[model samples]
Target: MNLRTLILLLIMVAIAALAVLNWPLLATPTTMSLGLTTVQAPLGLIMLALTALMAAMFLAYVLGLHGSVLLEARRHAKEMTAQRELADKAEASRFTELRSFLDVQHSAMLARMDALEARMSNRLKESDNSTAAYVGQLEDQLQRQGGSGSGGVQELRIEPGLRP
Candidate 1:
């Protein structure tokens, strides 16, 4: 047993022994004042009975206090559990929202990349067409210059003495 319980037990044993040893004295009648009048009664027994009654009341009070403390602790535990669940749900919702936002951004980025590719392809085709036109014009000029001269190679007289 704990020290406090052992000590209380010892004290109770001592009180019981004392009461047993003084039985004759406790049984003997004596004059006692009862507020309005005096009466002959066993004073020792009366005092012992009053002490036992008070001890019983104190025990009941202690039991009630302990029970109330246990109930309060249980209530607090339930409230903490509920709060934790709410926080978890809120965190999950935020993750879902973030995921949707990222998906939308990814889709938009893909669309922009496709648009850029189309524009680049159109520009490349335009560049190729312009390059081909320039080459065709140069061929036509060469053909006209050759047709104006004899069918053989043309001779240019930059100076009568020096031909290049």
Candidate 2:
């Protein structure tokens, strides 16, 4: 039992022991006084009974107070649990939002990289074609200038390594 209950039980035991020890005195008939009245009674037993009644009242009060405190504690615990759940949900939602934002950013960067690679490839092909056209025009001009010599028609062949 709790400390208060234990203490009350101890007190009750002490009172009972005292009553048993004084049973003859407690059983004797005597005149008792109230605030404005007098009555014939067994003084010791009546006093003992009144003390027991007061103890019972005190026990009832302690029980009521303990119950109210327990209820308040349970209510506080429930609020804490609800608050924790809300915080966890909010944290999870933030993580989900961050993940989606990162995904979008990553996709946009990949798209930009692809665009750059396509432009580079197109530029390399354009460079190769222009070089071939320029070489052809020079060869044709040289052939016309030298009319019929053995060295007049020197063909310029572009190797694959030299294409770009």
The candidate maximizing lDDT is 2
Candidate 1: C-alpha lDDT: 0.84
lDDT of 1 by residue, 47-137 (tens): 8888789878988998999999999999999999999999999999999999999999999999999999999999888778676666666
Off by more than 4 A, model 2: 1-8, 126-164
Worst 10 residues of 2 by lDDT: 155-164
Q: Please list the Cα RMSD from the true structure of every candidate, rounded to 1 decimal place.
A: 8.7, 5.4
Report how far off residue 5 is in candidate 1 (Å). Answer: 4.0
Q: Report the C-alpha displacement of residue 78, candidate 1, in angstroms.
A: 2.6
* Model 2 per-residue lDDT tens digits across residues 56-111: 89879989999999999999999999999999999999999999999999999999
Model 1 clashing residue pairs (backbone): none
Q: Taking the candidates one at a time, how many backbone clashes does each contain?
A: 0, 0
Clashing pairs in 2: none
